[model samples]
Target: MRSDVRDRIERAVDLMSTRMADEDAPPSLDELAGAAAFSKFHFHRVFRIVTGETCAQALARLRLARGTNALQRRERSVTDAAFLAGYGSSQSFAKALKMQTGKTASELRNEPHILARLVERLAHVEMAGGEAGPRLLAIEIARFDPFEIVAVRTEALYPDVAGTFSALASALGGTQGVTAIIGRAHDDLEGGVDGRPVFDCGFRLRAGDAAVPAGAEAMTVAGGEHLRARHIGSYRALPGTVDIIYRMILGRSDLILADRPTVFHYVDDPGETAEASLRTDIHVPICRIASPKEKESK
Candidate 1:
């Protein structure tokens, strides 16, 4: 089979579209992977490579986005929204949502999920390997609902990051939390306007907080609406995804981009050797753009 990354990504997106058609009923991972003709083991990585998020994370975000839309614009119930998102139990979902978002689902529905506004600015920074010089990139809008993630986190920068991660992994001792090491990049794709690329490299815990790495933090993804997609391949592939989102906004209705931080949601362990290349889920928090008239009034 041809190893065309775009083709595989389109297929994965198609599968996601199909799954969202009926939130109450969704496709299994194996079945979904089959749609893209990807290996069950390697499919998750491929999906992440193309879309920048894992299959599970994308699905959950889609569900939450739907639910957020409903809550904000319509008279929707949390339970109904949860059920539609394929949640087995609302209580469990809500609990996880509160942790990631720093607010309950109901709270977001009632109030805006705001990040201190960022100037709609553009800048440049270097890549991780230090091979390339600074490149121009912008931090765009993103919005996502809370989801569960088991991660090892620390306040460290690159080069030293690997060692810090090793120490964190050792401290974890296979206890609870994330079972896999997932990298979450909350900074701009351009490494932000600053030279430092802020990151939280951690593994998903198995059960409890006991497995949390020393000096690492554990939190649930706040439940709410999210503007998300998959980013296939290395961290270098992120810029393309951002461009696509901007184009989508231009073509779609007057959905203005808002100041929501973006997230690089990892699908597989970067340390794991796989038949396929690396992959990650790219998510941004965005709100609808206001009309010219609406903007003027504001």
Candidate 2:
């Protein structure tokens, strides 16, 4: 990354935070793109790469945050929150509240604890489409601790990881943290997979001595350098988010894509948590830049 890339992105996020805090709506994508001095063509990709959210996600988060706060305020009626949330009516707002928070609007109003997690998650609950979606992305390079994972590899018959993950879970029912779903995809699937794609679907072992689940294989992952970001709320948008990150990395001069596969860490259980409150972290392996030949490749 250029020295100015991070600095400029940080400035853009500061601007976004300020706008979200205002009583009025924020600037459009075009506006933020101009401010960032990043090309409009790559703005969304760059923003999502650095922030792990689309412009739409950012807008929805702010709208929901403001509305949820209104719900908690004694003076603010559900109607007030609805309008504050950019919803046309309380009915719509309430529907969104339940979908996003898994609680009625009344429940959130009466309980403060629930709101805290929502804020922490930065989840979005949009009733309808299209806010110019001028995107909080704090994209960072971080190291994950070394760990061992017991996972099921996708078979010829089972190309998708869904069934593989399920079988692993059933086999590991006795294991702790088996409910947490995590995966690694070796292929980008950019050009399309060769007969079957490569995916290792399962849980990271918490104990070193823990036996690998009957049907799974154990491997040690070094978990070194990776581009990391948090995506709170819903896996529905995950595919697009990952694409955006890939585009940004491909277009960048500083990024050196590592040989290893990308890791998807599913932070929350959608079955147990609301769709809007689901948490997912994407870890894109990155190579450390050093040699002049490597730097000169750009």
Candidate 3:
């Protein structure tokens, strides 16, 4: 895509994200085109190219996501989740939820059926509706001490993050100080600036005299409690694993999401690993919400 054209599309998508975040809905077609600075007649064509979905389709997906999260995480009742999700009633919200995810409000609320439903949903979406071969996903929690990294940033999508890693590697001339290579997504592509996801391709700095390269910046990765999941197979499937993680998170009453970027630690060298054999460990920052009794005591 032409840089100018891409920039315009990103600007419009950014606006859409802004509307979605603030209002739990999307703006009208005229508003979208205005945000893109294009004629309404022509903007849709370009937007479809950039995002691969109509404005309504994309926004609806985002809306469903908000409802799902709110229903799961914010102590919202089903009715509240529906209203915040822009639905007229809880029944309508339940129907839409079933249509999009093949699960009910109660199932989503408690996840009594999380395992059976989530894995199936993950495979179908990640495989693009292909036959769902076996997939493995597991979540665990661990405490991380403060660590450092030498990293480079880009506005590239996750699939294209390899180039940034290559550039960082070449700049450093070798992995002398590196303990592990990790990827950090700084923004959601759907809600990111100009609709482009920002990512950091970084090497974990070992505890030693490892020097930071001239071009890359040194920073401390967060240290705290994290919910981690292991992903097996292609990097493209990582999003599916992420969906499962969020679903699990929503079902929990004792855990609330912490404000931090989810980080992926590369467990295998993709250069030498088969696509099906690739291993990645994903870390989601989190905190334990005190129980009601604990809160009452405070």
How well is each residue in 1-298 modelled by candidate 1, as lDDT tens digits? 1224446556756666556745455566557657766444334433544454545555656555544444444466777766665666778657656654666776666564331110000001111111112322333344445555545554344334566566676777642355545555444333321234456666655555544444777756443444566655654555556546544542345443333334555575557745256655655444565688998998
Tens-digit lDDT track of model 2 for 1-298 = 3445545556666666567657566766556766776644345444555555556566667777778877667888999888988889999988877887789877776677877666555533221222212222856888887677788776332224556766776787743665356777654322111223356787876654457767689866668888887777656566556665555564466665665667888887555799888778888777665668866886
Off by over 4 Å in 2: 1-136, 155-160, 174-180, 189-191, 290-298
The TM-score obtained by model 1 is: 0.40
Best first by lDDT, ranked: 3, 2, 1
Per-residue alpha-carbon lDDT of candidate 3 for residues 1-298, written as tens digits (9 for 90 to 100)? 2344556667776777667657854776667777776544335434654455545556666666656666655467989878877888999988988987787888766673563444333222110112122334466887788677888877786677788888888787766666798887655423332445567789986677457777778867777888898888998878667655644553467764565667889988788799999999888777898898999999
Candidate 2 lDDT at 192 equals: 15
RMSD of each candidate relative to the true structure = 19.8, 15.7, 17.2
> What is the Cα-based TM-score of model 3?
0.55
Better of 2 and 3 by lDDT: 3
lDDT of 2 at 40: 44
Q: Output the lDDT of residue 65, model 3.
A: 62
The count of residue-pair clashes in candidate 1 stands at 47
Off by over 4 Å in 3: 1-137, 189-193, 296-298
TM-score to native of every candidate shown? 0.40, 0.48, 0.55
Candidate 2: clashing residue pairs, number: 1
Ranking, TM-score, top scorer first: 3, 2, 1
